[model samples]
Target: MGWLFLKVLLAGMTFSGLLYPLLDLSISGKTRAPKPNIVIILADDMGWGDLGANWAETKDTTNLDKMASEGMRFVDFHAAASTCSPSRASLLTGRLGLRNGVTHNFAVTSVGGLPLNETTLAEVLQQAGYVTAMIGKWHLGHHGSYHPNFRGFDYYFGIPYSHDMGCTDTPGYNYPPCPACPQSDGLWRNPERDCYTDVALPLYENLNIVEQPVNLSGLARKYLEKAVAFIEQASTSGRPFLLYMGLAHMHVPLSVTPPLENPGSQRPYRASLQEMDSLVGQIKDKVDHMAKENTLLWITGDNGPWAQKCELAGSVGPFFGLWQTHQGGSSAKQTTWEGGHRVPALAYWPGRVPANATSTALLRYCSIPTVELLESMGACRLSAWTITRPSTLLGEPKLVMGARVLSNSTLPLSFSTWKTMLQKLRPYREEAPSTRRCCQRSPGFLQMSFKTLLMTTAPERTTLRTLR
Candidate 1:
């Protein structure tokens, strides 16, 4: 009887494994997620090892650990670039910084920023009738044409760039003194620009200067409060909303609540991580209470940890490198190494994405375009059948090969290879199947530009550019 029971249990497991997709599709029945809300909580410079779910030895980041256990975690995830501006540009546009012309962070004095023409994720969702709000850091662009308000978000409450930028001469902050960094104590008016100008860090609320040199202590909590308020406002307004919460903790000059300072971790960075974890938990709890079934939540980091800060920088997980440089051609932060670009990605949607399941499938920040495309195809459904059901060509072998090329091939390691893959797949989305097949069949026929190869810089460590 025991042997028979064991056999029956094995059979049941096998049956469920095979039948799960069919059962799900049958129950869902070609239905789209009506009025589904989207929320993305992005942590700045938070490492994979910082979460208790990913690593056992972390200082009990309970909120993020709970998030991973409740959602689907991607073990092999990556940011589009290693730096703030480029990674963020990739996140919004579904393209690389090289393609988007945002290769580095914008300088304090210079007005450079992400190009205005590139489409952002917020823009796409907003076009699909979703109310959008961006709370926290907006590092992609700070200048006139490239600001968040102009890009897509309906409401923006965040700093123009990294908090570390525009460093002040204030005590306890050891930033390099800059000659042209607007040195002043109180608010000063730039009459020609018609905006408040100051040496201190400026915080903006929809193009207006709200605070300069925002108090570092309890800043993360303030951001969380703003996000919760925005969620409440958007929910009551009778419109689906997209809340992009780009967290500023764990970046630099880390601060934490007094309660979090001693009980869990004596280190400031650890305390900051603890605070961030609780903040995420609060937001997720709000979502669960309001719209668990109708909301899709994603939590991830912009890039790897800042290794230069030693004990204060956090861990890099099992990847590679410590600080800016490591042996074996591996590096962190500013370089193209896996340690630099790879970050955590977790997605949660009750009754949609499989709970507690992990997908090792490689994902890029650039695939956000596919999300936009899926949303544009009508009612959005978060399942495998959504793409396959709408388009008959996804199952074809040639298209599968194209998909495999994008997923499995080493071609995407370089920017040129990524361009080749995109050039081939763009047709698949455009309904030009013949063109896609032609492109896929002769994938190797595409010539690699010598200049592109020459332009590619080998990953190496240099002087630390920014604290972030």
Candidate 2:
């Protein structure tokens, strides 16, 4: 297995001090104080250039730009995988697609999901007494036990998969525009063009279908309302919470509200970007108002933009992947090129993460230090040998963080360390029969190699290599 290692340089006080309260309590065998809340906002198919802070040309993400100024922005952050299901699986499990058994997009008819046995971050937090909620685009799986509600989320609201995967009452703008669902649907097919017209996109609230063929235009507002409500309720209940919002914005079939002045003047993608930014701003405002002091707000994209969508797709900024593009095919989204997985990331914790700080260290969504930080805060109990303290990177701005990617022949060396525990939790299988196809090794899985990234900052540079 080959893993991409990125060095993370966090500019702030010693991270240990930030969690001293919880660590001290754990060591002294005392009841821990209130734990800080955690909110992870994941954008669907959003490109690295979508954030105005990351790309000067992107003016739509005003709220996100302000967030970068108020927090630490990572210049070399990446998603674990280049696609949806695998990326999301990695985020929640802190494991790559190989370990989590999700390496591709799941269909609406997928009989399985992220595997019922895999322990999710939500489950760990829930067990630690945190109220966990997931709002928007639960693409892991929608079948029976694989649903979000069964995956340890106390509340779930969103679509089963990507918005364009099914027909909706009002199909949003696209490069090749998609039509609305037929009023009386009896296997409505569009053979001339590539689009889903058979199944109706269903809006889910927990296990129940709130609305079949969801109104794409109004979905973003609904997500915002539900997110705010959950935050307020969890805050009032006096419990720390975890809100994992998987936004549908920046994805295909862009459902953006038209501007009042000129409805058709702005490009649909830019308009949608603005709408997404506004939604993010609202959510951030709610967090600031209710739990600004003790909450950590982290935002990043699941993967790169879907380049096939052309004008409707987001921007990849300067990660053009000339080497790959020169050959043939797209280097975005489904590919393992830098443009496919390298995403923009921002971390905000009012008094913790330094404001306006930029970290050049490479970091991936799958093995973020936040998981270790959460563990230190009594979120979950992992084996002592496997625990990496957040304090390790206190003064080391160029420290390399390593993780293993799935390969065809060999399992990760670290997998042996986790094997026993994983087996104890659930029977270890080489691959699940239902999702075996989806669990194939990543395309980039090959022998390890050394690759150095030259930092733009003067006199400070780091060398990175692929881990195997």
Best model number under TM-score: 2
| Model 2 agreement with the true structure over 296-315: per-residue lDDT tens digits | 88888888999888888888
Per-candidate total of colliding backbone pairs: 2, 3
Candidate whose lDDT is highest: 2
Model 2 spans > 4 angstroms off:
1-31, 258-264, 364-468
lDDT of every predicted structure (CA atoms): 0.61, 0.70
Writing each residue's lDDT as its tens digit, candidate 1 over 284-331 gives 999988888778788888877877666667666644432224343434
**Position 355, candidate 1: lDDT:** 64
What ranges in model 1 sit over 4 Å off? 1-33, 168-198, 259-265, 322-330, 364-468
Worst 10 residues of 1 by lDDT: 385-394
The alpha-carbon lDDT assigned to residue 7 of candidate 2 equals 19
Pairing residues by index, what is the TM-score of model 1?
0.67
